[model samples]
Target: MAVTVSPSRPHDTITGTPETGSQLTRIALIGNPNSGKTSLFNQLTGLNQKVGNFPGVTVDRKSGFAQLSSTRRAEIVDLPGTYSLYPKSLDEKVITDLLYDRGSAGYPDFVVVTVDASNLRRSLLLFSQLADLELPAILALNMTDVAERHGISIDIQALEQELGVPIVPMNARKGIGVAALKIVMAERLATHPVRFWEPNDELLPLVRQIRYYFNLHNDYLALHYAQQYRSISFLSVDDRQHIAELVAQSGFDATAWQAAETIARYQRINEVLLEAVTVTRTEKREPISNRIDKVLTHRVGGYAIFLGILFLLFQTIFAWAQYPMDLIDQGISALSELIQSSFAGPLVRLLTEGVLAGLGGVLIFIPQIALLFAFLAVLEETGYMARVTFLMDKLMRPFGLSGKSVVPLISGLACAVPAIMGARTIESWKDRMITIFVTPLMSCSARIPVYTVLVALVVPDRAVWGFLNLRGVALMGLYLLGVVAALGSAWVLKTLLKARERSYFIMEFPVYKWPRWKNVGITIWQKVSAFVWQAGKVIVAISILLWVLASYGPGQRQDAAEARVRAAAPAVATAVPDTTASQELERRVASVRLENSYAGLFGRGIEPVIRPLGFDWKIGIALLTSFAAREVFVGTISTIYSVGQDADLGTVQEKLRAEKDADGQLFFTPARAFSLLVFYVFAMQCMSTLAVTYRETKSWKWPLGQLVYMTGLAYVAALVVFQVLK
Candidate 1:
């Protein structure tokens, strides 16, 4: 069998030689999920990292610059974790695509495969596959500390000899053995090696034919091209057609061949492990993880514990964050007053009432957002998140969603943008689409401020059961309502959008461990920072825009209203003979000016439509502004009421409490507050979420449908709640 070798291009080798004067070497870090890959990446890259989407896919691509040595700098790309090159999910496919397509921008010069030292048997499968690709590879044996606890040991030299790769045993969580790993990476990037795995007799002839036709130097590379030619993005139409014809002629059954390859690979792995790995001791004892999983995964006890934890989380978010939230609010209020006192004119009003008020609204929610993200990060770091998914899978399946949907739905509580992005893991289109559709219905942290303000207005803060605060209980009820709505919507979607193929959910349950505080802190920082920066931009812009609309109107209506209020002020004061009369006159002037402003006109136009839901024109204006983001509702209300009421210094909630309707009834009556709460719960008010939905679905149809259905539901539900309560 004659195999034609392609010319040795710089891009062909796993550790490609850098071009003259180019000081950077590109390295790819590949690993199975829960193999401590991200921990290692964070340790190596520190703050020099950037996250982006992979080409032609929504899956995240994280890359960072790492200084391997004094003179050696490397760009490390952290490829999504996968079990093997034959991908079962979209994220896993990223690994195969980048590796098989040398023309890909993410194509690496060398590969560092991180494997769990405690689970060598399972981790070696991917390492072996990489070796078969004829790439220069380093094995990073992470979690060695955990392996020691389990009485597992490995002979490093023997493993290196057996696998024909350098094995660096490291505890990534503690930053151990990282220096040794870097040194090995720097040394191995200088060499190019041939394929490590020899093809079996049955596959050799076919591999040779593939190599010859494709001009491939490596047999394994040819094998992968034969298997994945159709899905490989780098292949041209002509190349794919030629490869297809050649593959057809060779009578290659991709499924059968892949199965054979896997079995053969495992057989070789057993041999390697036999010579290299050792079980230092075997004891008849239950693992700590297994012992804990018994209770955590128990049918009755599990749910009780989960509910208790959720209650505690909400309680903490509401209770612990109250102090910080108040501080932020006061600081922002003081700053706004300072800015107003210092500057005079429209710019000052815009700065204090518009921009600063909008920012204050967003920043006040930071305490809750940070707390929620911190809890989520801790759950994920402790590996308890997987158990939650596992527990919810049974419930999720009945709702027409795959087990994978649970992850997105649970994460939706934080933010729908990434949660919707997370739906990519669901292989079934119907399941993924349904997950995206209903994810936003879950009240996110953005809704926290709105919910807190409204709930505090209506629900008493006293404890319900002498321990559970009524406020916390109300918050939990809102969260539960969202979950019910999501599942109900998914059920309806399932009945409407029929599936052509069967859906299957497969996931790995990682062993439980103590949460890594550093990883948890990094995750919280990233999420909270992204939230503030992204939402802050929209909030500030909307605040300024709302200010412009509310400050000025057509035909000098605002000027006319202000002059009329000034003309009546002296007569009203003479009749009333009290300071309250003067204050009421000023309040009336502010109300009249707002009623005649552009924002008021727009709100009145929609008032008839939303009036049955107990929403007046002012609330209607807030509804319009909040579409940019839900948290902007508070800012919109604050800005509208703040105009001309400069003397009445009050928080958004206090101002809302002071608002009165045409009948002299409180605008935020319990009925109105509850109705508004219900409306926000179901409304598709977030434009960012809609944009993300479009990006994920690659069409406006789904997001548009989502907006219409959710908005309609909100209106109808709010109407019913208001009518019943009123």
Candidate 2:
């Protein structure tokens, strides 16, 4: 079979060989999940990059530039990792479109097909599909070290002979074969034809027939597995972009390409595996990986271990961050005091007290937030997160949530914005929408401060389960309750919305390795910094805005507050120091300013509606201030409480506990505390969250629905709790 090559693009410079002439180099890197595809991308692109979402979707598109010695600066698109080109799921279709040139997004000039060496047969099915498409592609055999360690060997020469593509071994984690990978990539880019050429036989004719049958007139043959092979490839393509591409490609083809390839690829891949790899005689010998997975994935016992892990995570987050959190509190408080002392005027005091202190209150959650993200990063890097979804799927599916949703919902335990964003992977719109809607119910880290304060004030620290810490267990229970609520809500949505076929739960159970410390560190650093930066900006801006609103009001309000405070001094305490009177005078001045300000007016305006919820005007004011974040409620209380006192970090909690209503009874009673908890539990209280949610989902619609339903449920539940407890 002789082959002819020609330059497809004007900039292409191919003389005798293939892609050498293709100037606008668009190469896609795709593979099975856990095949080290991302690690390969990191090696190729290093520091040259951009992260953007695909058009009309929230799924991330990470494209970068690679300077190959031979190809020069080539445009590289690191596609979402996918197993096959079939059009069943979005991710798979994204790769399909790139491979076939199906969508509005231009097609790739070539593709780098990544394969996990240990899972050769399954991975190669995708490679074979790429071959059928006749695309200029190179097969990158990733995880060579793991393959060798597991008694797996690959005859690279034979695979190349069979597939007509170069097979390069790579251990991306250690950069062992990266130099070779780049050389192969560069060589293929310069030597292959601008457009792919097939041997021109039954395979090409059959692929064409199917393309015509499916009406996929443009290309994308790899995604149109003949009808018989559809089910297998269907499981492989998870991303929406990939599936859309496959569907578009298949829409043209009338023939079935599915049946032929399933048998053909499996036989060839299996033969290759038999010749190149072997399993050890010591099958009974438990590798470290199996030993851990045994306990972690055990059907009955696994659930218990999962709960135990949740318990430990929250305890560490709440307990460990305390010392650092307290130190930050003290530092910020000292700074505020210094500012007050340096500037003697009322304006200076307002800036220090109302603005800076309020900002400090919001930032105080950072330490705990950082630590929680660190743990999540470790879990993800080590690959335990998949197993979590795997185990959770069984329970979650019964309640209208897909098992894959467990990861995002659990992620919401830290923050809902990213969790909502992460739901983009769900193939079904209904599933994704349900995931976005209910994820907020997963008791996020934002609720920790409120829980800590309440548990300390109401529920005493005690032990239960014999050796288990009871307070920690209670906290875990609250977190689990949120998960339960999420599942329940998702189920209701599932029932309400028209259902689709159950998604293929096809996920790679990657061989566990000791997590890469560098990857872990980078992940933790990025997440922590992003969270802090995002929350910090909003917290600061809102604090400043709130200060201005609370500090100065209109007309007679300021005059009246001053006169009342001044008149009370002589009648109530004649022997009090002039200094005390002056301090009282300042308090009166601050109060008048706040009452006349915008923030105060807003809070007071909503008082009537919130009054039945058992909150005073101060609580109402705090509610308005905390829209920046739920935990802002705590900081708002701290700042507002601080303004009237000489209290510092050490005495803030005590001051809060002793706060009284107009009747002189404790305002934060058991009934009130429980009511507050329920309110936080349900209210669409975090405006910053709503804003982020809107950006991620691209709608006022979903967030609006979320706010209405959650807040309504919260109101009813809290009302019930208050009535019953009181």
Candidate 3:
């Protein structure tokens, strides 16, 4: 392949850095969607990457720290991928605004342009746009292995000459050419000056004019030209209509200049390809992607497949997780008992019954939730997610959501926090808002404990189809009910907030590829760690507070109760025996302390109204305590019921079943448990979620509305469920 090399400048000088970057080498990775930009970034940054949101926006951001060599550690930031410099979505705006707004946190010292190997023409359009920006960049031809396997080869030397930047051919997926890329980077960092060149051709005048108008007196003319070309300028000719017309009559063939610029850029690219790239014609093999897609994407068959996939997920959580949950539960109780036996003080009770038990409750679900994500990541990476989205699009549109909304909805089965965050990918403002509103309805992992206890009490564990268990399916149905309610609510919101509607959806159907294990591992690590950090603290604090309130009472409460118990002791040498009378006295003493204590008073205050629906003062206390998290109901009720009995140990369901009301009738019957289940289904019982909602929406208003509306609905539903069932 022949090449054109502009004679090397005898000596090039390095440019001055921005004030803050005096001690750090800052590099940014930029490219169009599906250009292997993220893969390339993962290669460079590896395990050092971090995912965070941009300040004051919901857009996802990723940054990582890496060492370029033994002595140089550089900071790499991966900007959102965009087609052109023009901003369309809020996400694209993130990149464009940050680049132009020099006041941004860490502006890049260098940019890396990644191009897909198969689609060179479309890829070059963006490359040419970036080149005119005059930023120091290295254009890497990613996915070269795919191209080479297709008997295609790109001329690297010629492309480097034509684009005025180094061209590194590499397969990011295999780690090939990574070291070669590092060598080029090191050379650029050491010998070559950070260089941004003005295009040596006809497009220079328009670049100058646009610079004069939009940014008159600006110094970086070349970079500005590239920015405008990539930004909205190219999309609508009318955007630059006046300037374009004015330049037309000025007799410089302005339109021709821009056209010639486009033509020559491609011309040189083709000539470079003709010189360097060689195509050895070979018979293409049968694609496995289509073969697998046949059954997975069929309309009727696909629906069956999706259900099967969902069934497998639930079965694993419901059936397989029981063993670990039991072990974790036993471990928590054992640790608590050991602490209680070791010491004799309020501090021992606080540590054992409060913090340790509370933390265990939250962490116990980690295994099942992590498995759910692992399966989802595998499905998503294999490219079936797009098909799922396509199939669900029509069904979801009525609910004001897109197929993309399903990601968050499915993720909600694990936790609602990340599920809501995942909604950021939905493009339309209306659709995204709807997805966020309804995600919590999808029976999160937090609800599992409550559901397990209620289901065990109310529903029989029976079998159906071979390998299909009724209890597992019932759990799945509860999840599905939440989904149905969420979609129904969204339908109402869509009608209420009817702003505008259109069905134009633009999305990239990336080629089906195996799920990257590293990406999945990173996701699980981040989500699980953050979940523990955020919810663990709140639960622990609340548990400790409840322990204090329940353990000790004021004035004569403990004294009176202890004296009554002592009075019940059988007659010894010096004591009078009053067995039956003393037993009755002790019971009466306990009732008085429980009535006057803070939790007791609060419970009694709410008891009159709830008593009609079959809840005792103890149940009232559990309900109030559980507002921190809905699933806390099981543990709260378990503790309250256990407090009433002589036995110090038993499972939550056993305690709930044995609990009886003053009428001597069995409490927590099928009817009462069903009511409790309904209450949990719709309750606003998560403070962390409210905080996230306020943070996302930027006001206290929506979170307040959410609490009132959801809780009111839950109460009404609970009342109805109990009355009807009874």
Instruction: In model 3, state the lDDT of residue 622.
Output: 74
Candidate 2 stretches greater than 4 Å from native: 1-26, 47-49, 97-106, 187-261, 267-292, 319-370, 402-436, 442-484, 497-501, 529-548, 552-581, 634-673, 691-700, 722-726
> Which ranking of candidates, highest lDDT first?
1, 3, 2
Query: Which regions of candidate 3 are displaced past 4 Å?
Result: 1-14, 17-22, 187-287, 317-333, 411-433, 444-480, 495-504, 534-597, 608-616, 642-674, 687-706, 722-726
Q: On a 0 to 1 TM-score scale, where does candidate 1 land against the true structure?
A: 0.82
Q: Compare candidates 1 and 2 on TM-score and give the better one.
A: 1
Give the per-residue lDDT of model 1 (tens digit) for 1-726: 101111222212233464335557788999988899999998888777776678876566778888887777888899888888887656677788888767666678778889998888889888888877766777788888878777787777667667766567888888888887787776653233323366677777777887887677678888888898877766789988988887788788999988887888888788888987788887678777888989888988987887788778777876888899899989999998888788899889988978887788667767766777778778778888777767777878888987668767876886786677556556666788889999999999889878988998888879876899999998899899999999999998888996444566666878777887887777666655665665456656766787788778889898898898778677757576578777666667767787788888999999999999999888888888788789767766765665333333235568788888888978899999999999999999977677667666656798899999999999999999999999
User: Can you list the residue pairs that collide in candidate 3?
Assistant: 1-275, 85-230, 85-231, 86-230, 86-231, 86-232
Best by TM-score: 1
Model 1 lowest lDDT segment of ten: 1-10
The best-first sequence of candidates by TM-score reads: 1, 3, 2
User: Distance (Å) between predicted and true CA of 595, model 3?
Assistant: 5.4
> What does candidate 3 score on TM?
0.77
Per-candidate clash tally? 2, 50, 6
